[model samples]
Structures are given as structure tokens and as C-alpha cells.
Target: MSDTTSPARLVVLISGNGTNLQALLDACQDVSLAAQVVAVVSNRRDAYGLVRAQQAGVPTAYHPLKPYTDSGRTREDYDEDLAAIVSGFQPDLIVCAGWMQVLTPVFISRFADRLINLHPALPGLFPGTHAIERAFTAFQQGEIESSGAMVHFVVPAVDAGPVLDQIVVPILPHDQLDDFEERMHVHERILLVRAVQKWLTERASLPAV
Candidate 1:
């Protein structure tokens, strides 16, 4: 009665200090965790996650597929190569954490539903980058109560995927951007781990597709 007959394999893509990537590493230490990250890819040569990944004894690679002056490579072609690199790991789930590049349509279609992202906003609210700042601003404008985190399937649209899980963090009246971001990071890590666990459980209990 399981949707997936096999354990999910993860390939995490990061472009900065991968705080979330570290969380996933810690989560994998749990014997009950159903997913194992087999690879970590970054777009920056100096991303802190590369060092962390190296220390953790996980495989890591860099894919600088954009911002070229005259590499003469089209987006589709660049994505095709990137896909090949990620696919080399034969991953079941591809997680993007602070991966700043906008993936081309070809890249998205290549991975499709198997991709997931962790956003710092309550999603359906803040759609693109700088979500934490936007969330705090929204709170300041009396737009809402508590703002929080979300984990969803990655779609072509920014942060517009189906919700896998979410947690609402109480916004303290005197919170700053850094404070909110710290809290956001905590909830973001917790929510993503919980979501992955839930997704695995759901997959294991399904009658069929």
C-alpha cells in the first residue's frame, strides 16, 4: 500500500551558507529518517555549505551555470548539463536551499514534482526572494498575526507549489529582521525535516498512485 517502494534519495542544491543543509545532515543521523542525502550541489565557489558538506563526509559539487559574460551557452543547454550532473546521483528528491539561480523551464520540467523548496515566509503570501523581510513588513502593516515557514513541491512559479506542511511562528511586537530571520531559520529547519518525514510516511501508506 505504499506510494514509493523504495527509500527516497536526496540531492540538495545550495548557494550560500547551508544552514538548512546542515539540518538535513543532522536529520539523516536519525535511524528512523527515511531519506538520505546522497549529493550536495552549489552554484558558488565560496558557499559555506561546500565546506560543511566536506566535513560531513558527503559528496559535493559546484555548478556555475549562469552569470557568464560570453560562455555562449543558452539557459536550456546550461540546465540540461546541470540536470545531468544532479541526475548522475540518481536522486528521488531534489531539495533547493538558498539556490539563488532561477531555473529554466527545461530544468523544471526535467525534475518536475520531485523537487522541493523551503521558504522563509508563510507562502501564498510572500512569493519571491527577501521573503523574511517582506513577512516582517507585512506584520508591521497590520496585515496579519504570526508569520512562519513552509515546505512545498517546487514549481516553475516562485514559492507557488502545493503545501506539504507549514508552521506559524508568533511575531513578537519588537522583533527585528535578524531576530525574525533567526526564528525563521529555526522553524524553517524544523518544518522541512517534519515535512520530509511526513511525505515519506504518506508515500509508504498510499494504496497506489
Candidate 2:
């Protein structure tokens, strides 16, 4: 845990291009933000997010799932090791930017209140993968009027966590799938930064440990 006097340490997890991670990294450059990204971890070694973290001079780690599975290790055991690696950073907060894996309950419980995720859809709308595409399909069928992005606390259940902040992105009639997805990414980045800053502000009000 970090006190108000010290900068909060962050560990970010990503599975793809880490645009949201980049946003947080940029935000940390402002000394007033009171947070620092200590490390970036990816389940995929090839994730571009690692490169971004490296370029930013932040530490990077990779913990692939297949190797563990191949060795007859249970998901729980793998997560335990993963938690240990993340805990080594002593993160005050952990953000899942584009991490595609559904975290096991053991890992979620270990981090508890410190874990969060940025999902590219409105809460309770599109919970799983292909969220943007699903939302676009719903729009094409006139099944929905709008789609959005959210930053929420991470729980054992996938995408069922309480939302911290969200931005409602309207679905325009002329919006194509690619265009709409690009717009949603913009909203995601903004909302993610907002939620993190909000957490920092709230945490700042707490008494020192």
C-alpha cells in the first residue's frame, strides 16, 4: 500500500497494442498525478504493450499460460505464480488494459480492491470478447441506440465488476464498424485515465498507513 505522500505504483497487463497503457504512461509524466507505472506484464510475449513499456523505460514481464498448462499445472497454480510476480512490484493498483485472459478467482482475491479493468463497452452490455463488433452488430439491427466504454473494478466474474467511470458513445447512422470501433477506443482511453486519476484522488484523502 502507498501513502498519500508517496506515488502509487501501477502494474499494467496487456494482450495487444497498449494504447490505454500508453495513455496512463503519458498521464504519469505529470508530477501532480501522484502515480508511477512500475511495470507492464503480458501473457503474450509478442504483445506490443511490452515494447511500449520498454520504450517508456518501465520494466516488462511475460507470463505465458500455455507453458504452464503443458506442464500439467492447474490454472490456480499458474495464477499463484503470476500473483507472486506481480506482488514483487508491490503495486498499489493493477490495470488490465487489453489482457484477454479471464483471471482466476485466486488471483482476483489476491489483489482484491486494487485490481481494475478497462472494457470497451458499456456495463452489462457486451461482457466478453468481440464487444465492439457485437455492439456494432446490434446497432446494425436497430437493437441498440448507443455503445460505450467503462473502467471498472475487477472481480472473479468476467466484466461483472462495479463500474468506476464510463463514457456513453453514441452510435451514428453513418458510422461504419471500423469507424465506430476507432471512436470507442478513443473513449476507452479517456475513461481509463479518468478512472485511474479518480482513484488516485480518492486515495490521497486517506490517512497515512
Clashing pairs in 1: none
Per-residue lDDT of model 2, residues 1-209, tens digit only: 76667889999989989999999999888664579999999999889999999999999999999988999999998899989999999999999999999999989999988899999888899998999999999999989999999989999889999988899998899998989988998888888888998988878887766
For each candidate, give its TM-score against the true structure. Answer: 0.91, 0.97
Candidate 2 least-lDDT 10 residues: 26-35
| Residue-wise C-alpha lDDT for candidate 1, range 19-67, written one tens digit per residue | 9998888888774567788899998999999998898888999888655
Clashing pairs in 2: none
The clash number for model 1 is 0
Worst 10 residues of 1 by lDDT: 1-10
Candidate 1 runs further than 4 Å off: 1-6, 67-69, 207-209
Q: Could you list the CA RMSD of all candidates, in the order they appear?
A: 2.4, 1.1
Model 1 TM-score (2 dp) = 0.91
